[model samples]
Target: MTPEALSGETLRLADAVAADLEGVERLGVAYSGGVDSATLLALAVRALGPERVVALLGVSPSLAARERTIAHRVADLIGAEVVEIRTHEGEREEYRRNDVDRCFYCKDELFTRIDDEVARELGLDAVAYGENADDAQRPDRPGAEAATQHRVLRPLARIGMVKPQVRDVARVLSLPVADKPAAPCLASRIPHGQEVTPEKLAQIEQLEAALIDAGFSDCRVRHHGDIARLELPADELPRAVAPGIREQLQRAGKDAGFRHVALDLGGMQSGAFTLQILNARGSL
Candidate 1:
């Protein structure tokens, strides 16, 4: 669909969201600063006003500092009260195990904490998050289960909004994150079954930052033991493999603590490692 078509849908969805928040005295939103959550926060602020809207950001070791900065900026733009709550997902054994469903435990801790602490402390009527309709079809997203368990209200999903629609709303509201790529957690760079460590997360973050500084915007630094697999956009693959640039990337990866660095010629695919495992198991 065209951007205009998406924008029209978002306008309708925003109206629906405003209608949904009409009776809520105080609304608490689980904000991540992505287009989805940003759009939701903007609409919520319009409906309930800044005084009644609170944006709750769950701070954790896995969360990138850049993402937190964006979250704060978005809250500031909307004049919403932003609450930074520390989440202990890394301390949880289930999350540390790094299973495919690791996000479940992390999100469970996050939502539970927000529901009990942030909501109660702030006297919020409802706890809401930005889970759009498109996410319903993604089987790999375990966080959705946690949202359901914690009874977190999903206004975007309830109103039938999707990723494109969220971006559309964000554009209409002039949110900076309207076109930002999805940035999951730093721990996602590690393969499932691998224990997540502070050092490994740091390494991935440093490598990714380096790649971005080198002009590779959409990229992933997948950690596998001492090997760093760089995934760049298909169009950027040639540039990444160029002799001089490849040498520079190799040196940067080494500096980031990787013994060997290799670019994935298969291109940049979201959940590439997961897809590989699934394909190996005949599940794809």
Candidate 2:
């Protein structure tokens, strides 16, 4: 859509977000440095001044150092001050188990810490997270449950905004991460039922960073103990499997401690594994 058409169609969304923040002197935004949260941060700052907005990023083994660095840059671009707080989600046995409900425990801990500590110390009136309408269609998202339990605001979902609209709004606001690909937690690289450990998370991060350094921007390196399953866009899979490039791919995976490197020719898909589990359980 053209910028004008995009704005006209989504103007009500912005209005609803502003209305949601009404009566709140200050807002603490749960930021992950992704496009969704970055757009929310920009909107919060636009409706309220930079001084009224605080970007709260919960950091730990799950969050990548690259993402944290980019988050700081995005916050600076938005002129919103960011606070990086170390979260102990890894210490939670439920999270360490890496079950289907892993996200619930992880987010529960982060939101609990922010609500009990960050909000109290910062004198924030309300806490909000970036959950768009597209995310609402997914039954596997456990983070939303934590948000509901904490009574956190989901203005984007409330306003019926989806991923595309959020990106458009970010572009209109001149945010740097308008079109950035989704980057979920590093722990997500581990399949369900696998124990989540700092070492596994670090290996995943290292492998993903190596892939990006080698020119695969949007990809996922799923960890399966000694096996590394690489997921890239369908158009980019050839580059990973091509004659000489395949060797480089193996080196990258091996350097990250993977005994075998395999390619998922079906390509990179978000929530692919989660969808399978949800479908089998008749939950989706």
Q: Which candidate is the best by TM-score?
A: 2
Write one digit per residue (lDDT tens) for candidate 1, span 85-172.
9999888888888978888998899888887677778998888888888987676788999988888888888888888878877887
> What residue runs in model 2 are displaced by over 4 Å at the alpha carbon?
1-7
Residue pairs clashing, model 1:
none
- Residue-level lDDT of model 2, residues 1-284, one tens digit each, is 22244356456666677788888899999998898898888778877888999999999989988999999999998899999888999999999998888899998998999977788899898999999999977888998999999999988988889999999888877777888989999888888888999999999999899888888868899999899999998999889978888999899999999999999988988987677887888987
CA lDDT, every prediction? Answer: 0.85, 0.88
**Deviation (Å) of 239 in candidate 2:** 0.6
Which candidate number has the best lDDT?
2
| Candidate 1 Cα errors over 4 Å, as ranges | 1-8, 275-284
